[model samples]
Target: MSHHFDYPSDETLDISDAYCFAGAGDAHGPRTVFGMNTSPFGAPTWNATGYYELKIDTDGDYIEDITYRATFPIGSDGTQHVQVEQLTGAAARDRTATGMIITPPNAPIGQVVECQGGITLFAGERLDPFYNFIPYPVATTTALKDGTFPDFPAAGPASDSFANTGVRSLVLEVPVKITGREPVHFWATTAYFDKGHNTWIQVQRAGKPNMTTFFDFANGTAKIADYNGTAPTIDLVGRPAHPATDPATGIWGQVRDNIAAVVEAGGTYDQLPHAFPTPRAYGAWAADRLLPNVVKFIPGTVALWDPWCDIQNGKGIIEDIASNIIKMIVNQDFSSGLTPGPVLDYFPYLSTPPPPAS
Candidate 1:
């Protein structure tokens, strides 16, 4: 349920979503995770020139609290080594990578590189962890505009279409203490420093699942690259905040309009809660799902539990949005397919890929 292959390059293909698993481990008093795919669908090189960043907000304000930067540098043997750093203070914008731990990427699908600062790093090919049955292209191309999108209530449980696909995943297991052990929001981005330009340009980013798959190309229009290049602050909150009637402003604004248009034209209000009572009310509730694109992980909890969903469920200001829409899309059934097989009961929890088809 993400913008897989929505962007125009290998760098942006299949960047599904930032998947979170909390209390999956407790090697360090309690651990939380934030993982995503980068340069996922090709024989791409994660060599010395690229940067993978994970940003966290501890204060619930949606601002970056600490940034964790991961990079791959070529070693003497010409193999890529994973190096990570914690960026605090002004280093987030300044791009200063301090506090370093260098190690090789995971190997044999079972080896996890235990890095410094109670963090574990794994970068390798793994079975795509995300699972769902919706055919996005079919849904968006034919139904969204025509207002014939499938009805989840009437439809049987959707199949898992991505069951066999693989992604170049970057997974991190960070201790709660480092993250201040509170409710924290996290997102991932891929960037590289341009030697000629002497600057960093973001090429890919993801926070909430399905942002690109559903909203970026709302109403049959493409904001793929524009959405990728914009920062979360600007994308979620406008350059200068304004009323809902303002022009299609940022990413969420465009998405709200897109969903509202579809909701209005398609008469899909029956899909939303009856409490909405009206189309406008439903649109407003549906639109609130898109802002502050990040995953909220309350430390030391089982993932998808009521408490976890509670903290993650409350809608904050424009600075934040809960994971309710996706949760809601699942139709109140919480225990199925959230994290199917391929979950190892240890560090770097994704399961090893199946052996090649016989």
Candidate 2:
């Protein structure tokens, strides 16, 4: 079996990406969107049974500062219920919701549900706005599995496979005051309250666009459940000594060591000093970007240098960084796939899925 098939499980959570962007003209308000592509063809709807959580870590510590838990009870006619809870400090255990129920508009296709206090919520299918060269994945997966570790290059005119596909999205719009400060981080997950264990268990999660797609989980399937269950605060260094490793004692030291080995063995590209001092430094830097599993949304800052561009927060810049690292496996550039579209100006912000082929 191919390494790609060997790892990454059954794609129970094909989350392409999650986004947080500033609202347009204050009419829409600041927005956070979570997207997931269901696997196994036509599985149960995400909200049909369990909890879909949009977690925000406001302080850059990779811990949840606010958690929005959206639940769809078995008996609901069609409406979904959501609870917003704020967490504080290092432990991040405190959770308190304002006792609000955010309802979706009657019609979901283009409907935007405005909850009390200027909060808006939307849930349904929309075109997947994220794009990247399809060739990039093929090249990297081959290299990582074969241990060749060649230099992957720029997109070179490659197209996006996901461009025509759609992802189920959960969007929330809130006032600026709630976002706290600039450079806010966001991630999303699906969890179910397990009656047998009497605890909420996470089945899937995503943060930065391609964290799990590239990084190796040394322990593989043994620790994958733990990886999903835990928050992103754990550093990406080495295999955890056990499945229950603490976030504070994460294996960052092991990460640096692994990077040293790869760099020394000529498995990775040379350092780009603007980003890091050495390959090991770059490894740690990349780990920080990936492990947090949070999207950094910077308000008032133009992430993409284009005209009439809505704030992409840090998504564009992060995609660029992800592109740069991809060059390590093959020197291709896929920037053409990252163009802006009409989706930026709409209510359910993603672009419309490509029409079915004749």
* Candidate 1 residue lDDT tens string, 102-148: 44342322347776677777777777666655543335434334544
Candidate 1 to truth, TM: 0.79
Roughly what TM-score does model 2 have, to 2 decimal places?
Answer: 0.71
Off by over 4 Å in 2: 1-14, 27-44, 74-99, 104-110, 151-157, 219-223, 236-278, 289-291, 304-313, 316-342, 353-358
lDDT of 2 at 92: 37
lDDT of each: 0.57, 0.49
Off by over 4 Å in 1: 12-14, 24-28, 96-99, 102-110, 134-137, 140-158, 217-220, 238-248, 270-274, 305-339
Best-performing candidate as measured by lDDT: 1
Q: Estimate, for each residue in 66-87, the C-alpha lDDT of model 2 and write its tens digit.
A: 6666654433466544433333
How well does each candidate superpose onto the true structure, as a TM-score?
0.79, 0.71
Q: What does the lDDT read for residue 145 in candidate 1? A: 42
